[model samples]
Target chain A: MTNPTAAMLVIGDEILSGRTRDSNMHHLARELTLRGIDLRESRVVSDDHDGIVAAVRALAAAHDHVFTSGGIGPTHDDITAEAVAAAMDTPIGVRDDARGILAAHYEARGVELNAARLRMARIPDGATLIDNPVSAAPGFSLRNVHVMAGVPRIFEAMLAGLLPSIPGGRPVLSQSVRVERGEGDVAEPLADLAKAHPALSIGSYPFSENGVTGTNIVIRGAEGAEIEAALVQLSERFGA
Target chain B: MTNPTAAMLVIGDEILSGRTRDSNMHHLARELTLRGIDLRESRVVSDDHDGIVAAVRALAAAHDHVFTSGGIGPTHDDITAEAVAAAMDTPIGVRDDARGILAAHYEARGVELNAARLRMARIPDGATLIDNPVSAAPGFSLRNVHVMAGVPRIFEAMLAGLLPSIPGGRPVLSQSVRVERGEGDVAEPLADLAKAHPALSIGSYPFSENGVTGTNIVIRGAEGAEIEAALVQLSERFGA
Candidate 1:
């Protein structure tokens, strides 16, 4: 069976502006890959309404699952929840379950849930909440879209709570062979190996470090034995 | 002047499969932001022809400038140049100018320009070359789209040669205030600050380290003095 396809939308201005480097995309990519989901495409957009709304619609329609990170916090710049609702043409309100979760956590800490804090309880219609064990404000899953917080810790927590319910196929297996030569010396053999193994993908990446040039040949496929078989032929060709 | 809007397309399977973490997106994002070019969106697609072609077409049309990284090598998986040509409805061939450069470089090194090696000389019609100083395989710019190598060093070399020619606007200025408290403590004041500073963008990011919760408040805008002015109020409000 084919792996369930997935896409990610990382929304934030800080990530685009160079103030913060986004780690969630890589995290989600690794997680989804391990779960046997084919992460086909990923997009990063600013916190603007049009960009967010358009990306959500496009990715949700194209893939089986869509994961979004960032722009889901409790500040004015956090417009992900509203923009997501707009994308799905749904009405969002202060969800009772969400409010109860946040209210209980805040009351126990002797902190009042003000208007800005209460905004965290705003959930899109027909969506279920994804637990955020790190913080009280929960993320939500609207149809195929899973909207999570931008913070690394909170996003991971939400994903752990959400991944088990989603279906996946066999995980794609990969192996790499390093060769002490430039790409020019390795391209011909690598291309020939690719022709031999029609089901596998062979990638040649050249690297130069401190005046030393080398190439890394990676073999990827769904079957572990097939990738290892390809690696054997590649190792004999390059003497890696 | 408004910042020139740009989008990026990163083509590779390793990134999508999580075999390799993508650093070029962050590198390009930082560079574009510093040059006053608004990098509005970025995409990552596998080494498939249709995916690359569709992304190149869509991003090129939507933004003022488009940048793509990866799939410009000599192996079988290296198909970005052909895909890009398809996207713009242009023909691709081994151009004489590119061939001459590659021939000279290879001849000097006593290397033969075989079919596999010569494939690197293929260039889309009506495109000017972007020089790669690190390696001899040059990148190309077709209209508003700039296609460069995937390697970090080579991509940076090509970008260093290309960024000077592109027009830019006033760089966006930024400053940050870190508070040793959770986002709930800062959301209200941060929202009020965001409302007051209409021209500036205020972002709050939460972090937890060894059981200590902290929030980082960032202020960004094109005006340096206005950002500095906003920072003073934020520091006073958060007592940072």
Candidate 2:
């Protein structure tokens, strides 16, 4: 099959309250696209244990692969690992491999490995460690769920490590034409174009500029040439 | 009791395939924050009936309100309304109110109210209508699930219409200070500041530019003055 399905679970209270702009979702979406893994669903849950557990269980069962970000830190609110364990009905404890990684990191930095730091060493049972080049604490994978750190740098590094281990499908391709016209003016034509390209996905994103509206018509498909042809047609019809 | 918990369900295959960039989540996050409703979770599921049905049930049970976007269009890929009906075990049919609104819209545009267009009017039974001012294909709310159109303009207009009917809590307030320093350099002091403010939520988002790293320290709480005080303390510690 050319379509490999995946989902994302983002766990953090900061993101929920608009206290932070989530960059990880965009990064993951792009990375997964490059890997030809269709990131079918993404969920952002708070640090609440029950919420995390429920989302994990639901997403894991539905998607072929599930990637989670956030709540794996040493802070009081970080609870993804435990929640994942609870959701899977599996045991969770500090594993030797994860502990060794944390210990070596703290040792190199010459900082005392406190109880809070040791919290990062805990992993769900039957999970394999995913190395983090940017940070010492490791992410892990159990069954279909890939648990990574919430911090963007650590998350990206962990994803890099994990992507290579999974098989991917054919990459999706996209082409865009920026039209200096309002979507209201282009809606009919765009709708007609979309209908003609039954196998392709087309979207018109409108933006306002200095009281004038413009639309960016994007055509996407698994075939690059088809997207290119659509782009050419769109430009010929509506491009400035 | 004043803090309302909410979740967003984005149903579409375009998002999962990276064919579309999700703008609705960010908009909902901002709108919910202003309304004092905590948007604790967001899920993006595909056009699949099972996935949407499962996500709707899980989120509605866990949240005070669940808002779903997409899959309510006129196309075959649009299956959210049906999925929601299946999830709630309610029969799906063209709502009288919704059909009137959509028919009026088509009439105004001198377009035929075709079968495909009627597809947009088929809503779950016993749901309240949410008016879409931009397009007039009204969304509906069943229990706590508020279904809205996928198009940004239409979705936003529908949200504006629905926001007033829903009760909200005290809005979250935040203040931020950008410090041109690494996370490790500021973590300890920031942690202390966080400890001092028991009611406030403090987060450190670190970034890099031109090989120089910096952290944007955010202090958020219900009290404006408390957040301002935290910002002052943060500036005193690390401000340029």
Q: Please name the candidate that would achieve the greatest TM-score relative to the true structure.
A: 1
**Deviation (Å) of A68 in candidate 1:** 0.8
Show where candidate 1 strays beyond 4 Å. B210-212, B235-240
Please, what is the TM-score per model?
Answer: 0.95, 0.76
* Candidate 2 stretches greater than 4 Å from native: A1-4, A33-36, A85-126, A169-240, B89-92, B177-199, B210-214, B224-240
Task: List DockQ, one per candidate, in order.
Answer: 0.72, 0.29
A88-149 in candidate 1: lDDT tens per residue?
Answer: 99999999999999999999988889887899999998999999997779999999999999
lDDT of 2 by residue, A10-76 (tens): 9887777766667787788888888788887788887789989888998899789999998776655
Clashing pairs in 2: none
Which residue pairs in candidate 1 collide?
A: none
TM-score on 0 to 1 scale for chain A of candidate 2: 0.93
